[model samples]
Target: MTGDAAAVAAERVAGVAGELAARVTAYDALRDHRAVFAYTYFRLTSDLAAGLRTNNPPFRAPEWVADLSVSLAAAYFAAMDAIDTWLGPVPDARPGGEVLSADLPETVPEPWRDVYAASTVRHSYVLEEVLFSMMAHMSYDLPLALRALAARGDVHHRIADFHRMNSLLASSVDVVQAEIATRYCRRLRSLDRLFVRDDELFTSYGIRVARGLAWFNCDRLLDPDASAEALGSISRSTAAFIAEFRSPDDWRRRRAFQVLRALVPSRRQWPAPAAPVAVGSSPG
Candidate 1:
């Protein structure tokens, strides 16, 4: 492709990736405290995997693995649906200001809009396969690791402090005008550390995003004469951040793209429909 055409493609990719990032990042931020946490979490991860897997190799994920992955994502979505039934919408349109609605390629703040935008692009599918779906599945899997700690009750009791936490978060945002003004840069840095991976998958993921941004970012800091150098720097920084935060745990080196590996049963086999009962359950 011509340099200009390639540049345009990169810009488009960046926009898509940015939207996906926004959704994923937003869900993660809200998942712990908001009523919408479950919904946002599943939706965002499902969408992310959908996008990432397209570039994934064949047989990297088998049928059973794929099915379970999709199911895990749906479970989170279902959990969100349940929350909506009992509680209510988590309020995507927070009261902070107009920062989220601002145009992209510019104006969009660092982490919030950027992450949500990434989630959106990841979910946009062309056919039967969805890259984000896998991500959504993986996202659900992350919390599932803690399910043993939460099995005492259903969603609400499991996430008992949600409302309080969300309330605190909401109040914090209102103190400022725009999201940028309100955003805790410390929080962003902290979370980036939490999810970033230096391994192959994460490295590739970061590179892809950086490449997308390089193609799209028209920031004055990236003049054509220095664009290559700038892109290299950005890519390295992203990779470094991602590597610093991630673990060998999420990389899936154990199973080689086996989706089931991400799915940890509460206390049984893969895709266990029901939770295992304790050896000493009372007689009916």
Candidate 2:
């Protein structure tokens, strides 16, 4: 990686403040929002920050949640700086002093356009799949987390949006990831006879997991006891599969199986039945 890449990775910002504000002002006004809402919000921001610092391209978020948060922040500042630099030349709108629209057209617009485009990347793609994966990841023991909270009873509007949008966003990312993984494997193995060893090769994969974790902040996944149970089962099954691979005898086989297993949730964590509709359903 380049020095610039390292610099970018080292960069940090306070997104937690924003998340907290949203929870207090916009999310469910009742239902002990602190217990369920704040934890998920903070967890998401924390995970997002970690993911960005450790991502490939030195800090590219493989999935859209982190991509949206980090890129939007970067894009916002970059655009502002560009605008400030452009404005620096202009002293005043004094008569005989011509304000140049030409300069604004040239330098200012391009950066802003780029920034705006970067900001909305998540809204335009599959995020649900990421949410689904995050729900199943073993790190949080999400099943226990949800069960501890028990049934939330009624769905709050903010929670509803979080579930539906996150799931859809993750779904988009999954499609892209599957396609990218296929190409990465094919080219690295047989298609181009290319050497596979590279430092950044695994960066994308890590970012994917990080963003996946952020997506899990969707409140619906965390509140529903059944969904949590489902996730718990999948996590255990995945852990079991990975354990088998840890033995020296199964190294190569396990590695290959890992790739195949990547798409499927751990069977142990996966619920045998569909989760109850506490909120509404996603569009078919």
Candidate 3:
């Protein structure tokens, strides 16, 4: 892509990120736990937009990275919209009628369904919600975004830019964590001090590993010989990964409990879900 094209794409990314930031602020006002991941994502997207606008962008192919970022963001928003629709009251139903099951629509990706369900559960911690959102986005949405980009043109040359995204993601962690601490979970600040260096290290490492797997899966997706089967396998693996995170026997859950125990007095408190805003109601 030409420099001008890259600039256009970067602007689009910035626009999307700005819209997401607005949504995060609104979610925060509602004391919605979804803001945990939404805020983190907004920071990451904001950073990417900034990087793309830099005179000497870190990405070798700025346009490709910008496009992929926008695509991924679109996927996230689509899934969230689907969740809202799925969870909303059934249209024109009689009073006290049986509502639809909690299952998301078939159009909603499986991994995201799990994340939405987990986020709504009472007493779930911030870190678990964050991790589940990350897993769903990275494991399920990313490969599909990559494949879409690949279908348009060769993405082999853009591999470096894809890997470079990890650094961009890492740089935003401290700021994201601090903001989440201030806005959503006060205990996150205390938890950060308890783990300190290990907290960031583990978070960054897990992101790198997940993104690396995403790229590997992208390769599998692009393979002409197995693309059909690869798609099914990717979906299955993503579902299983999320299920493991939801499992009681999972080490991550056990560790989260230990962290919860260590910070006994500072248990995470979630606010009640806000009443739905009336249509045409302007945000205060």
Q: State which candidate has the highest lDDT.
A: 3
Off by over 4 Å in 3: 1-6, 89-102, 189-202, 246-284
RMSD (CA, Å), each prediction: 24.2, 22.7, 6.3
What's the lDDT for all of these models? Answer: 0.29, 0.33, 0.68
Candidate 1 shows a clash count of: 40
Off by over 4 Å in 2: 1-140, 148-163, 172-235, 244-284
List model 3 lDDT by residue over 1-284, tens digit each. Answer: 46676677668778777767766766666555677788778777877777777623556677777789888989999987776566554434312222222456777787776676666554456766677778778877998899899889988888778778887777667676766676567877665354343333226677788888888888998888977887787666645654555444757766875665455543455434563322211122
Ranking by lDDT: 3, 2, 1
Residue 150, model 3, lDDT: 85
Provide the global lDDT of candidate 1 against the true structure. 0.29
- Tell me model 2's lDDT, rounded to 2 decimals: 0.33
| TM-score, prediction 1 | 0.23
Q: Could you give candidate 2's per-residue lDDT for residues 1-284 as a string of tens digits? A: 34444334334323542443344332123211121223233333443344444442233223322323444334333443465465454435311322333334344433232222222222211122222223323223322332333343332323333243333333343333343234222222232111122111123454344334533533435546656664544434432322332222546655654453445332111111332212111111
Best by TM-score: 3
What is the per-residue lDDT of model 1 for residues 1-284, given as tens digits with 9 covering 90 to 100? 23343334333433333433343344434532221222223233333333223322122212222332343434444433443343335455433222221333332222222222323332111110112222222222323322322243333232323222222222332221122111222232232222223222222343244323322332312345864664445323422332232223556532432332244211111112232211111111
Model 2 scores worst on lDDT over the 10 consecutive residues at: 275-284
